[model samples]
Target: MCCALAVPLPVGTAAAIDDQQFNELKDLVTKLGQKIEKQDLRIEQLEKTHAQDAQVHAQDQKTHEQDQRKIQELQQKLEETQQAVSNVQTAAIAVPVEPLPRVPLDEATVNHNFSILGDAEFQYAKTSGQHGTFLFADFAPIFLYRGGEKVLFEAGFDFGLQNNAPNSPGATTTINLSFAQLDYLMNDYVTLVAGDMVLPLGTYSERTAGWLNKIPDDPLPRDLLPGAGVGAQLRGAVPLGESGKLINYSVWGVNGASSADGTGNADQLDLGGNVGLRSDNAVANLHGKPSGGARVGWFMPFKPHYDLELGLSGQSGEWDNAGQHLWSAGVLDASLHLGSTVEVKGEYIRSCYGSDDHGNVRPEGWWLQASYKLVGLNLDWPVINNLELVNRYDSIHDGLGTRTRRYTLGYIYYFSNTLLFEGGYEFLHSNDPTQKDQLIFQLSYGF
Candidate 1:
């Protein structure tokens, strides 16, 4: 085995098996192993890189979605805010402003003029004492106006006709100037009225003289208490306090007996005055609420129960043959209102002529009346809107004549506050042969 091993080896084969070949083989094997390990490491690293990249991309996508949602929400909020602002702007432009108060008419530029307003009333009567129908018409046109500061013109005409007789001279149709006067408003607190002016004895004679029968008609003392005569009057209001306390006064100088019916001399002068007080919560507290006032008066002619007048007069004009007579008269009036629906009014008056005169002269006489009103009644849709019912009672007593009592029932239907239809029935009773009971109807229009 030793000889074979020594002689049998090939030269190239032996040389190929030297140290360099062995070393080269070993190096190549090691390099191949290292390459395999490096390839495995590279693959693992690639997987880890891919996973990190995916996680990062997922996080970025989530952040982008959140940002998108936030942007959408902000856009929606902005849109809603713009809509609210737009609505506010629209409302601001839609509302309307209020108007200012109106100015009063200038009295300096005022025109003084006369106006005529009259109505004819017909009566059908069948009384216990008499049975007859009377047709009568009253035509009265008054002239009144404010002329500057010192001069005011007032005049009126009265025409009464009775249809009782066809051929007979119709009951001496009396035509006369009910009132003719020139008044001077001396100042805000005083005035002077002369010529045929209203006597300041009664409330009806002075306060309501301008519009007769526009309210209820007055009789006896109210109708004949020296209504118009040659007189001078002073009227004004005196304030007692800033609480709206006031004293209203009217003083007049009138022809006593000679001024009767505007036929006697304008010689003797009678004096009269009225005092009143007024107070209102509207003025006291400045709240513009409703208010009220009252008045009392005195006259030179002394009449019983008449606090207004006390006097003595001697006539020398037309009653020369007739003996002199003492005359007296007075009045008391009051008015009050509650809210818009209720009102209260009252008045009394008396006049007397001394017993020295013949049977023609009479004792004191007086009359009184009152009324109430209710407003707004709803019926159906629009059938009954504004409606009111009124009831009134009146009585008069004159010493020379009988006592008269009257009852009135009335209704008013209003198309508006200013326009309405008034209808009523009046029942009368008297103890005089010449006077008879009657039923009356009237239609009134006013503005």
Candidate 2:
């Protein structure tokens, strides 16, 4: 169809197509206003990071509740220090305190041996001349040995049972070997001590413990000394400064105790008067000469807890065995403690036998004892807190001077530290006028 014709022309054909669609609609409204300002700045940075994660989880739950209240106040102070150590272990007197800081023993490597200690006793006696004696009486067992800084040894044995008189149907029992010693040490002030010894003479036959005696015997000058002998001794100790004082010494040489004569089968432990030398632990020497002695002491310088001990001892032997007769002795002992609640012990012993034989025989003695401690009066009463209270006075003289005056009174109760119970009452009195005024009653149980 190649032939066309047009006519009208107005405004140059609509102003050039409306100025190119108005410049593309102004670039699509400036690209949606820059994408709504980048999505409002990413929603305000995610709401400030969710409020800083809820304020750091509330400060970690308040620091885990103050560390659980400091672990419940350290478990309630460890249960009140374990109930005060269970009330000081049931209390049977001993109260000091604080003693668990160890680390001490190093006596040059300490080699030990033996190490046993024992005690047993059960006795009852009644007198008014004789007749009421129950006996199982005594059993010891001591033994200790050490060999570190130079040797040491000690031994013990004793057993007794008797009847032959009070109801005499014959009972007489025996077993004895009451001390076998040996010590060497020759250093810190020397020490020697050999064989059967134990006559250090004073403190109730060598430093206490005849069942811990709160009385049920052991006070009448303990048989005028010489209760053990077969000896050889030197003993030691001397340290007098640092305020502890101390100066102890012993000297010996023995085989000395005598006076026996009921001869026949021979082994008796006093069926009245030392017949076979009382079953013999020592006490067998009768003649040849060889009795020696000495004891010197001092301790604790007055008061560091209040204690003091003083001693003096002596002996001379040969007491009848066909070689004539001669004997001698002297001892004076003392002990005093005050802070552990009173204690005063004493002894005076003076002996002689056939002083040159003018029909010879002389005897002498003395004693005193005291005790007190009702737990120092702070008593809350655990049976008076292990009680105590004791008293004794003694005398015995004869060899022709006669005299006999005894008096004892006692009470002990301990209950632990092994165990204890004792009771006593003696009374005697005599100047002879036919003599025979007695009254005794004792009961015991050591442990």
Candidate 3:
């Protein structure tokens, strides 16, 4: 409803416009209108593209929501499955299972029930004014058999190489049965032993055999006693109280001493000749009397490896072919242990022989020995700690007319618990010219 008024041009402006100019201006307006229409079409196309993009975005958002819901549902299912698995595991742990059957243990068989043990030694000796030589090579083997729970059999053998004579050029090998015995445990406090048993004379023959002798030789007085006796013995120990103290005892009956040549001569006396057959073809005891011996010992322990022991032993029997003579022996032994470092022991032995020539011949001796271990110093040295110093004083009077005394200083080097190297120097004093000072070395092993 708007109206426009067109005013006539001025006289100068009208004159300036020609027909050609008018036509050119109309063409320029037509071209501008066409450009405006193209611009409008481009704007409409852009709007349509924007609309399509919005529709696609909406569809994508819906798909995303659906996917999110599916994910949450899957998470819920996973939690439920995990809880179910947890409950199953807990229930399984609470459940009980049956046990397997047990098999009975078998008894020990005899083939595997026995043990073998023993000792061996080698020695070198030199006396004054004499050449040093290898003294002896000795091997002792012990066999132990467990017959049953309450029965045992044990035997020991000694094999040695020695000179045939004092100045012999060759050696003689000897094999001797040291001891063979069967032990029957009568009860908790008693054992019965039979056969050639080691006589509990003074504990020396039993306790200091072979390598057990700290010195290379036995004590001079031990020669008076028989090492073993063909006998039956009853031995046992009794607890004094609960304070780790006890009393041990042994009683035995055996074939006693016999004449070496079926004679009553004192010089021909033999302590170990009663076990063999005689020239008279008599397989019997020459004295025709069984000897009896007994020993009682008291042991007191104040602490581990610290103890004192005192023992008294005696034996008597006829020793002549006429059975008119008798032999008797008595021994008193004592041992003291201050600790693992100090040890002292000794024995006094006395024996009487009733004979035709010498009347009642008496042979007696005593020996005292002490040892100290260097380990007591706690020096932290392996070699010095394994060393032990030993000393002994021994005296003996032969039933004849000879008396001898000896002092020995020794040292022991231990290569291991059961292997030892020992050396000693003896200072001798004796009435007999045959007795002389000596030096001895021994290598000993025990197993």
Candidate 4:
């Protein structure tokens, strides 16, 4: 509008313009007014667009903050989840899981769990200046039961028939429970045994039981120790090296030696007594304290049929009903095998007992036995191969000025691994008049 006003009009027409020029000037002024109105509208529209753009920018900034908050929340949640997983893993490591139940055994397995094995013996005997006679018959059976994966139950019984007296019509029948025990395999090198177990005071009680003994009769010194005891024991063998050598050990606690007549009388001492009930209505094991014993042995094998074993064993405890006297015993045992058929074994036993009349008396004995299988000679003769030569020397002292010595020569004929015929002649010398030389024959079968 100012430019239009500033426009110079014709100088002569300034005071009194013509009608045609004045109308044209009015038209130009109206057009300029319309242009100014449009300019004002454009400026208002620009301001409105700027305000809308600023509002949009502020909204975008708010959205970006919300997104940042969401990401932070997600990261925190993830961290919490990871911690929870770690805690769960730790708990799993610390806790123990229950084992699965065992499957029941089938009928066949149950039947197979039980096994029976044993031996029977028939014997004839003759003593010096005495007529020969049938001595005794023995039937022994061993029962075995598999209780579990690591458990076993075993029992042995002996039934015997013998002459009661020198011309007596009545015969004697005796029954004995040798040993009944539960064995548990505690580990690779340990076993736990309980109940009436064979005492491991020496190797003879276990190794020479029943048909395993080549001799018809026990060694004289063996009567000094109890064969079995009611007790619990821990036993095992430990491998020594790679040469098949091992060390065996046993530790036991039991009702040991006790007075037969509840007295500390030396003459009335009984090795196989102290069981069941006494005359006084007292239970067995008259002594208040149980006895303790142990055996340790080393067995070394150089080759097949070539080996040596040495063992030391002992026991000690009170014996009398009053528990005033103590009894103790020690044993040293050794055995050697040479080649396939020559074997030698021996035992030295020493014992002491406190008696009221005798104070302390010491009894000692030793025995040595040897056998040679003729098959070891590589003889082509079958008869000779089936025959084995045996010899033994045994001595004993009763610790009361009574002593005995014996020498035995014997032969064993083996029909099979489980059947044998054994015969022997003994030469005996003794301070006691009752002991004399004897002849013995035995027919033994093991199944």
| Clashes per candidate (backbone, < 3 Å) | 12, 0, 0, 0
**Per-prediction TM-score:** 0.53, 0.28, 0.74, 0.74
Q: What local lDDT does model 1 show for residue 446? A: 35
Candidate 4 on 1-447: residue-level lDDT in tens?
A: 989999887877765667778899999999999999999999999999999999999999999999999999999999999999999999998999888998876544665789999999998999888998885568999999987778899999999886679977987899999999999999999999999899988899999867788888889998889999888999999999899999999999888888777889887666656655677797766778988999999999999989999999999888887888888999999999998789999999999999999999999999999999999888799999999999999999979998999999999999998899999999999989999889999999999
Clashing pairs in 2: none
* Model 3 agreement with the true structure over 45-107: per-residue lDDT tens digits: 999999999999999999999999999999999999999999999998999977889754344
Q: Please state the error at residue 366 of candidate 2 in Å.
A: 6.3
Give the per-residue Cα lDDT of candidate 3 at 368.
94
Q: Model 2, 118-152: lDDT tens per residue?
A: 68777666666667766677888787878655678
The lDDT for every candidate, in the order shown, is 0.51, 0.70, 0.90, 0.90
Candidate 3 is scored at a TM of 0.74
lDDT of 1 at 212: 31
* Candidate 4, run of 10 with poorest lDDT: 268-277
